[model samples]
Target: MLPISALSGAPIVGRATVASIRLRLPLPEQLPPAVRDHIEAHAGSQNRQYLYVPSPVIADQDASAPLCAFVSIDYASDAETELVEVSRGKMLKSFLKQNFSRDADGDQILAALFHMVEHLPCYLLRYSDVVAAAQALETAFANGDAPSLMMPVLPAVENVELGWGDSEPDQPLVRRAQATVVDLEGEAFGVSADQRNIVHLDKGALRVLGLFDVRTREREVVDILSAAFPTVDAAQIENDVSGAVRRFRRAGLLVAT
Candidate 1:
């Protein structure tokens, strides 16, 4: 016997997939008056919070002049910050010893110290034992024994070295040199290896030295000078060149080939 199926007339529907579409909305040209006003107020508040305002520590100064600067602190840990503070304390102490009065008040001292560390002359203290050198330099200026204001010719040297020596009460104090080159405001300086003293070369000295070549005779230095200073008398230029060569040789910065 065969079984009979009942109510088999139901409709069968096929499955269909739906695709998704994204729509980008355009910004409005204008906002409501109140909404626009609220937005402007918010922007003004942000500006007030983040705007750069110069320190008002000075009085009657030009607004354009920067008396004090700000630097942001960035450190990975508390130890790093502490290390920086320690270094700053040492630098401040060193700077005060060389430049400021011993009896200055705490506020004045701090202000001056801050200025020194923030300025270009600060590098002298940072890089070298400059307390003695600074005193000697000042004395030289006072005694009129300073190097000639006029520029000098420079001779090429094989090496520069720095050394330190004990200072005697009766003798002039000289800065102890280190075994490194000092770069100050873009000027390169080296201590003489033979003399164990610091040597400084100015722009004019560097310019004159740049002309030196193996084929250039020592006497030809004056010729180079003539080209450098066409307006100056040849005799005076020659004398200056000769003086420079002697000075450099004595300092052991230059050697005869």
Candidate 2:
């Protein structure tokens, strides 16, 4: 799958793993980096819940409320029963909505998780991808923008190789086939197939890349471009196509047959 790190507000695509964090708070606000870092590093990996207390209460070290928050992560393919959120108070559902939004109904965040996470009978605001998404929430604060709903995700980089490549026969190379393209301040950015790298394509390369796909042969791609710009020489079109395909494949942006 394609990494969504490139789509994040902070968008630092590198050799990073994806993890989840849930924030249980009365209201939404900017999470200091210290808090975020503390949660990311100390949070248990066994899917156990952790009591997170911000600056004022970090020293106390308990799930006591009115100030602190609870932190937890959900993994893909986890084996928990119900999709329900288990908390001391059922009213905490609203916190789940605003912090990790999904759709306009403010429930879109969990909509995707509904298919993946195990049942948790507790009060918590879960994140499908906190590394990327935590920055998203902080983005609104940094830019002074209004809060919005999103299930903002990052590639769940598992320590285990979830699976291997697909079994298809001689599939044609496709451009951005298992990828997503986004505009970062007018620049075109995308993720690699392995979901570990971020790549940027220039206007020329991107335009050429768009012309190739699993269903289209390389010759047809060249022909399409040639007909589109009749003034350009056919040889030039072929070279452009070849160059883009080579660069894209090397960067994992284009699939190889």
Output the number of the TM-score-best candidate.
Answer: 2
Residue 103 lDDT in candidate 1:
53
Assess candidate 1 and give its lDDT. Answer: 0.36
| Segments in model 2 whose C-alpha atoms lie over 4 Å from true places | 1-171, 193-195
lDDT tens digits by residue: candidate 2, 40-81: 566543323444433322223222211112223343333332
Report RMSD (Å) for each prediction in the order shown: 32.1, 17.7
CA displacement after TM-score superposition, residue 22 of candidate 1 (Å): 84
- lDDT of each residue in 4-101, candidate 1, tens digit only: 11111221111222211111122123335653454444432223224222222332321222212112222221221211122333344444454434
Quote each prediction's TM-score.
Answer: 0.30, 0.34
| Backbone clash tally (model 1) | 2
Cα error of candidate 1 at position 66, Å:
31
